[model samples]
Target: MNQHVASGGTAEAIAALVSRFGDRALTGLSVRDLHAHDESHHPASRPDIVVFPNSTEEVAEIAAIANRYRVPIVPFGAGSGLEGGAIPVAGGISLDTSRLDRILDIRPDDMIVRVEAGVRRQEMNRQLRDTGLFFPVDPGADASIGGMVSTGASGTNAVRFGVMRENVLGLTVVTADGRIVRTGSLARKSSSGYDLTRLFVGSEGTLGIVTEVILRLHPIPDAVSAIAGFQTLAGAVSAVIDIKRAGLSIGRVELLDEALVAVINRHETLALAPLPTLFFEFHGNPESIATLSDVIAAIVADHGGTPLRWAKNADEARRIWETRRVGLGWAKAERPGAQSWPTDVCVPLSSLADAVLDTHADIRASQIPAYIVGHVGDGNFHCVFMSDPDDAQEQAEVHRLAGRIVVRALAVGGTATGEHGVGLGKRAFQEAEHGAEAVALMRTLKVALDPLNILNPGKILPELADPEHSN
Candidate 1:
């Protein structure tokens, strides 16, 4: 196996890690650089070795090797994660889990599916299509289930089916010292001990590497529809709160700010009105569908929304959603020099409109190219700020804007991060967001599980979470 010759001790440790897998291991491959970084704004640091394991046994073996060698080992999925979750900043071994892609079991009767970590969310959905069951946690990146689980990701659908943390029934994870542990149960509820499953779900691979995942599936709804509510964003936000209070079961609710609408109009070559909009999907029978839409539409009008349009078929629905799924990228295209700084915040239903309006003023005052999109029914939205990462001043200003927004969210009893886990990028703000006590607790758990700090070092929680706890 080829390994990095420089960096002396770390290279040697990585080399020793490779030795455990014999010639089957790979080292110093240029592919390691590809595996080293993720889609974050952070700089990439290539791992000394990259291992693609086909089975959970191999994952355990690699983790064991890394543990023995005292080298940092980073587990990765599709590498589409926005935070620095998959990036190996402390260079050592990168355990690429993509090769483990497999559907191990599908218990349709129980509405659960057991699959290897690397299976993509869309792939699982495709396989389950004919089974009248669907796993609905979509991150809009065709992200792997492993990556999704790692970051505790949720997309536009989170307003309904919930995020990965709720959807995951159980998991087979390889802990820091390389012991395989399974948490949770297949049955609906469990008074389980410690709830390690949740502990690992959003841990971002700091505590353990998930090898397999059991996900809950919802039955296919009788109808799929998308309705666009045209309004000033404030109106759209108000309408959603009203609709939800009326006890309507909205499958999905999305908000696209005027900035996003303009960008999508140009990028997708669709002449949509350059106004804030809300998209809705309703489940259940045709009668219930009509009733909900009419009620929601009337509320939309009452809130000063106008020109509402519902998708005519699946094709139209796909077009509308495809745009929302990739709207961040499209918004960045508006400014040639800008990239995306995505901040996920969820506020209370009563305060959603104020949060959005404040975000608008923040963008204007910052004088930055930005767009906003939300899964509104749940009061969560993303402000995609287009920024110049190489410019120190610009980066600082972007982060400053983000901090203010996060502070506002927290002030209103919301969270700094709703779906995106507190990866390396969010470490500095964890104390402010979660309070010092909660952060200390997270640190204690980290030290308890990964005593040596060999797994995904410098990620999620700050430092080694006390570092002196015995394994």
Candidate 2:
């Protein structure tokens, strides 16, 4: 649609892929529709064909064929992305990576694992259960490793373990021209020539399609999780700042506003008090964890929070974390038939209280059924707006409200997107968040890596600026 493909070239490319992949290359409407859009509120756009490659070689071949025909290649993972990163807006080839599932190698000694793009986070952790080490970058969605890498995803554990960018040590990428290139290394640190791994880590499959990832793993430490309720959301946020300032080794720190806690209680069938709450997980040896818990308990008390309630056992801890994981789902259940516009923004630690409070105020004023939940440890938070799908005015208002949130974060020295990459949903804010020149440079890099504009086009960057025309 955007000249990424030649007239009738998509059909030819599909024919070529089908010939190579047999039944794995699907043209059925249902599959196309499934790959059309992600979890975002963006409108769906089905791909002309969905190709599943079982190996990096096959992925390279798909790229080669797509490049030859000028067909756009949209690499799709689990489609759990909040932004429209996996959406095939140009509708050419949706290169679904599910068939490439493989845990190629696990160096338990090195605390690293190499996996194909299709391996899900939970599945990887399950495999690592016996190893005493686990992949810690949990984006909560059981998202595929490739999708997590593409979106630069992070979750509750990110405050301690870091995001995809830091955890991902190496990658096997199939570039736009179908070249198989390996970036980064197994070694922990390097003064390498170019950090291509990072470039592709959050490129959202625009620069290239990631086929395999080598991820850093962490030893499963003795974890103790607790919940603290507060009278106001601001108090909970302030407690988070104090916990961080105290230099506590907090594994996970989350904040759920009173409304969201109520939703979680009703949906999860838990009778926890419907109050602004802070959920925390501390990791260390048992003695250290005990001391850390005591320190945290005192900090929360100082900030007007309820006494910390420790999870009695692992099952209780799982349930506590699970509640945070399925927050979006429970929110949807809270208001049946309402669509959710899940948006997130991260601010500096000092601005966390103001950001959460101001955003909560915005939600109350809008009169929209929205809930606030965030991984507040790193000053990142999400507001899930549940609006009637048929209510066009409500949809527009939510979009504007989300924009204001992003603007607020940017003003306070924060990112437009904390983890969800600059997919279609956040494209408009790129320039506002990073200046026009920086965005233009991003375009130049995109063009240099993907000259044909055939790799996940119309994503990340709102519009492609002609490098030759740029100053």
Please give the clash total of every predicted structure, in order.
1, 0
Superposed by TM-score, candidate 1 places the C-alpha of residue 389 at a distance from the truth, in angstroms, of 2.5
TM-scores of all candidate predictions against the true structure: 0.94, 0.96
Summing lDDT over every window of 10 consecutive residues in candidate 1, give the lowest-scoring window.
1-10
- lDDT of residue 439 for candidate 2: 87
lDDT, each prediction: 0.80, 0.88
TM-score of 2: 0.96
Pull out the clashing pairs in model 1. 2-27
lDDT for position 379 in model 2: 89
Best by TM-score: 2
The C-alpha local distance difference test score for the whole of candidate 1 amounts to: 0.80
| Model 2 per-residue lDDT tens digits across residues 1-471 | 232333448778988998998999999999999999898888899999999888999999999999999888999999999988999988899999888889999999998999999999898899999999999998878799999999999988899999999999999999999999999999987888899999999999989999999999899888888899998888899999888888998999988889888877777655677799888898888888876777888889888999988999999999998888777687887777898888889899899889988899999999789999899998899998999888899988998999999999999999888888888888888888889999888978987988888898878886545433221
For residues 1-471, could you state the per-residue lDDT of candidate 1 as single tens digits? 011112235666656656666654677567887887787776788877888888888888877777766778888899998888888877787888888789999889999999999998888899999899999888888888988888999987787789988999899999878798988888877886888888888888888999999999999876666555465778888888988888888888888888778777788754677778777778888887877777777887898887467777888877877777777776776678677888888888888899999999889787778888888888898898889878899889988988888889989988878887777667767877788899888878877888787778777665433334321
What are the C-alpha RMSDs, in order, of all predicted structures?
A: 3.5, 2.0
